[model samples]
Target: MTETLRASAPPVATGAGAIAVLRDLASYVDARAEAFSARSSWLVAAATHLAGEPVVVVAHEDGQVVGLAALSVTRHRGTARVTLLGGELNDYGQLHHDGPRAARALAGALVDWLRAQRRWSLDLTQLAPEDPALAALVRLLPGAVVSPGAPMPRIEGVGTSYRVKRDRRRKATGAFNAAGRDGLRAEKLVLDDLAGLERWLPALVEVRRARDHASGRRSQLDDPGVLAFHTSVVRGAVAAGAGVVHVMLVEDEVAGFVTVLVDGDTHRLYDGRVAERWLAYRGGTVCDIEAVLRAQDDPGVHTFDWLRGWTEAKFGNAEVVRAGLHASSHPSVDRLDRWEATARRRLKAALPDAAVRRIVSR
Candidate 1:
């Protein structure tokens, strides 16, 4: 396939203009009937909220929308980042097409466009090492580096066989029991029966903030765009039977919260946070346990994945039955060989390469 690069064209990218493009994106995704990253309603919602001064690029072949990707340019620390926005949204997402070289072409076009912006660097965190789509990225962007984002653990799932490891099951059960003895409790709340949306949003954000404080991490809920996306898209998921929010609470206060996308019989764990003080209770890890088990309990729901991870917490743990991430993102040539090697070398220089390799390998 020949490469066709197109920058974010304006006529189709204004606030109202993007709607049609976004709709096209959604339609292109559905046309595949293939599980896709850009297809998630929640992600689209998040993008719609955060896509300020952003660029939307589309790839075409013989007049058909073969592939597309969005770049949200957000100003951070006096610099603008062409972020792929892979959070609760698309951490484990891959190229949206199965056609020959379509994924690679899409990725290459995006990287070439980003380089045109004349930015200091392009940041793509937590892309799976062997993704074919990224194969073209290194060639396009010669100085890019790949690094781990947040550490999100997941269970392995195959064609029709996906299960959490025995050790993880044992430890999760033990953690649940131990925490339970200390007055820690976690219940997956179904807001289906809740009175109305007026009250849920506030409690929702508050619970998330508390959980993040407990986990010693920032709360995504505190972000206006993220919270708004949840409120808007979650309603749609519930209506479609593909959306459910799992609230993990310790007693009366909210310990942690996760908003999951129940697409058919499978559930993709999306955005989440754990209260900081609850770290002693393994709030984040255990919260994942509680959410995953709840998803598994439903006969309609069979799989749960914590989108992406480069940290040791989720990726290298037993909780992951399978371990891979969104295989998108372009890294420079040297960094491609050891995508995370530099970071590992500097921070973990004291340790042996093998030991650091396990922790840093995505």
Candidate 2:
């Protein structure tokens, strides 16, 4: 039986009710949904704290949210551009939808919405190559430019074996003995409530700052807006019982940490950082191994996603999946946007890291 579909009005802002529904739909539709990014909580949080205007399009069936797309309108190089909300931090780009039919309807609605917002060209990043949303977009927008994005590594059946656990202990003891550090411990904080998130978030941010400074790089979390968005999204996910924070300490100080989000059966490491000084002690390895143990114990989770990176040596043994990038615009502006993007990439590559950071912050 065919379902009746009706797209909501050009969305200026989504109400709480609709947003909640969209949040659930994301997990329902995407098997490997990065809860921190795919959920509507991310969209709402980004809209609240990040710059630029928010644009959301919704498709409903029987008065329930069946599909949706959340976007932001901003000026890029003096031209209005539309991009996926939370694109900078999000691991994947997907149209939140119920199924194949809803995907097609949502794609059609996106086309109409894009036409109405004629001044803005679309640029979506990190789309999974096999995503129905990507397929729908390509089918409808044949002229859209498509490119390959980074590969996302994932580990299935992530439970640690007896040998792995023994190796971990051996490494920890050896490192502790060599460093002469007696106060070494790891704590995996299962932040299922807002109060816990509030308590630990500041320390996590500071750890990230210290790590960046040690590595001679700047942390994006240093930006007040980005920090606020992350706070909101994590809090929202934790409150929904879908996320947690794992922190490892040395001498009772934060040494390394990672945020994990469980979307259905998949566990994802959203972000993590380790202090440079602690690298000698395998701080990051300890934290990640513990995450794998946690996932193994949880009957609800079966896979652990390492997210976007080709660090084979670091990950040991994990499978790789393809991610994608794409852009679409009116023929008049397509060439212009593409050219401007190429120029910006080239200039960014040529400039010093500090110079590029300054330009991006502005």
Candidate 3:
């Protein structure tokens, strides 16, 4: 007999009860090596709390949880929009499923359920281009608008060595030399540095705030919730052996920091910050090159992901593209989203490279 799979957004009690369920579901589906962000219980827990009125949809087969999707429901101008949880913090938003068959089933059930809801429109954003759920949604809802999100640049085949281009390598070497001359040294932060992380977190926030201010842009670190979420994630991920933090110090003073998530053979550069004053010493570039070199030395690491964005300085040697995905149920919303996307592309194309970078980096 074929396994019967059913998807439902079961009501969950607020606070502790919801957290437990989210953790359980994350652990259940996180067994796969490629689960990355989806498998992070701490991230899920943070997202659930951060997303106002969270709705968790799970697919059950033979009474076992086989797939799950977390969403945030918010009303805007009498129209309710359901978005993937975690907001801008999430690099990719996709359903966690056991297999392709289960994925299709889960997607169908989810679309059907969303359709039956009141004043609701589905908005799936920042999904991987090849995410099964994206294809499933397109097939299920022909009227849904699909658009491109930011580009994800990654360096493949990092197990034995890195594949930096000649010019980029020379530039990195120059930065490293400059950093050494400036008395800057790079070091990895270990589990014992949990307390040290507490001190460093604020410094990183300050660095980011300073940089953003200099560029006339708003920093997400200004938000207490984003700050708290990252603090929770870094602590939890480091304790779980799923992440590491690398820092550049100049004679006991922190100059820059980078956080990375390790998943099987892949090392994802999640976030980083460099003090504005240290820019002249090329502290940020030096720290990043050091981190990449360390990842290359790790026998278990085969790929280094720069995450979302396309920057020549950092991702000039990117071997693969991890495109983001988006879809909307409302026709007007879909058209508007597409228009915005098109406008962004056109503007990017018309502006100078440096101006484009400033616009996107803001």
Candidate 4:
């Protein structure tokens, strides 16, 4: 039996209409067990609003929305390009589909639609290597390019007792003690602290800026759009009970802060920053350890995800490698995207820490 599938780009509206679509799509994705950050209606709406355009592509199977490919269109160097809706903010780009057959049909249809629109390219980076939709798209689009994505570090067993290396554990504990001796107190930001969140956000941006300047690098928060988007999303997430912020203060002055996103049993560290003046006290490390402890204590959290990158801090925990995908009707564009991705990996490998940070911050 042949399954009928059709794809269409729907105009996304705000308010009640948007919520209705999100509710329906979220329900469908949850039923298929293909839920992820990008697939969430909240995130989709936020991404669309931040992008200031509507580019949601829906795949309907027998008159029901079974899959979607949300994208944001932007002009780069005189050429329009389309990227996953949340862009770099999303750790993983999802193509929410009912199953393999539906995924294949959606992939083919999406490709045809994209070609007809004549976009320069479509980039979906930092996808899990084993993502079903990625495999389907690659299989259907012969010109698609595959590349390695930054490896995201994660700490599993959040709700259980997890073991850490003895030396690292000792160091983390020592940092916590040092902070305590310095009269630094840690607290989790709650819904009631919306005002505090507003205050601390700009402080975090400043701290990040100072740290990056000292290290001779740029900060992503330097971009007005990125900063605005983060501020809006974090505010919305907190209101929706989907996010939390942890803060460490010294004499009532903000010293460090960490923002995390909650999705069911998992918590992802979205961003973190520490005042440069507090580095000697290791405020950042202390804040991180406290955040981990809180996650372990919370009955709702079962895993702590450091998100898409490996660092020394994540060494004692488990890690996962994600991949990136690029596809275009033009073979040359596909090759170029692949080459650029490979070059980025190589550059990151060869550059000094400060130089690499500068490159990535942009």
Residue-pair clashes per candidate, as listed?
A: 17, 0, 0, 1
TM-score on alpha carbons, each prediction:
0.63, 0.78, 0.79, 0.78
What's the candidate order when arranged by decreasing TM-score?
3, 4, 2, 1
lDDT of 4: 0.66
- Cα lDDT, model 4, residue 71: 63
Window of ten residues with lowest summed lDDT in model 3: 1-10
lDDT of 1 by residue, 1-362 (tens): 21212223232253445444655466455555323344535346656775455455656656555666554566543334555544335554444554547777677667666655553345444455565655566666554444445554555442235545577667756655666788666554554433433345466677666655444445566667766766676666656656566554566555556666665655666666666555555545665665666765666664566665544444322242112222223334224435556765676667665664444332
Winner on TM-score (2 vs 3): 3
Kindly state the number of residue pairs that clash in model 2.
0
Candidate 2 C-alpha lDDT tens digits along 1-362: 11221333333344444344344444443443445576556776776788777767776666655677887778765456777877678786666777788778777888777776556567787766676777888877756767777777776765643113566656644654544554455443445577877887888888787777655456778789888987777777788888887776666666677888877888888878876767776556666766766887776677788888776323535655545545555565777866978997897688887775565444
Q: What TM-score does candidate 4 get on C-alpha atoms?
A: 0.78
Candidate 2 TM-score versus the reference: 0.78
Candidate 2: list runs displaced more than 4 Å: 1-36, 60-65, 160-169, 176-197, 312-322, 330-362
lDDT string, candidate 4, 1-362, tens digits: 11222223243333344444555465454454422456565455455455534355666666656677666667654345777667777776676677777677667767766666664677887766776778888887767788987777777886575634467657866765676676766443432256757776777778777777667566666767667767777877776777778777665555677788777788878778777777766666766776777787887777888887776666436777778887666666656667989997897678887776656456
Q: Pick by TM-score: which candidate is best?
A: 3
RMSD after CA superposition, every candidate? 8.6, 4.7, 5.4, 5.4
What is each predicted model's overall lDDT from 0 to 1?
0.53, 0.67, 0.65, 0.66
Q: Which is better, 1 or 4, measured by TM-score?
A: 4
Indicate the worst ten consecutive residues by lDDT in candidate 4: 1-10
By lDDT, highest first, what's the ranking? 2, 4, 3, 1
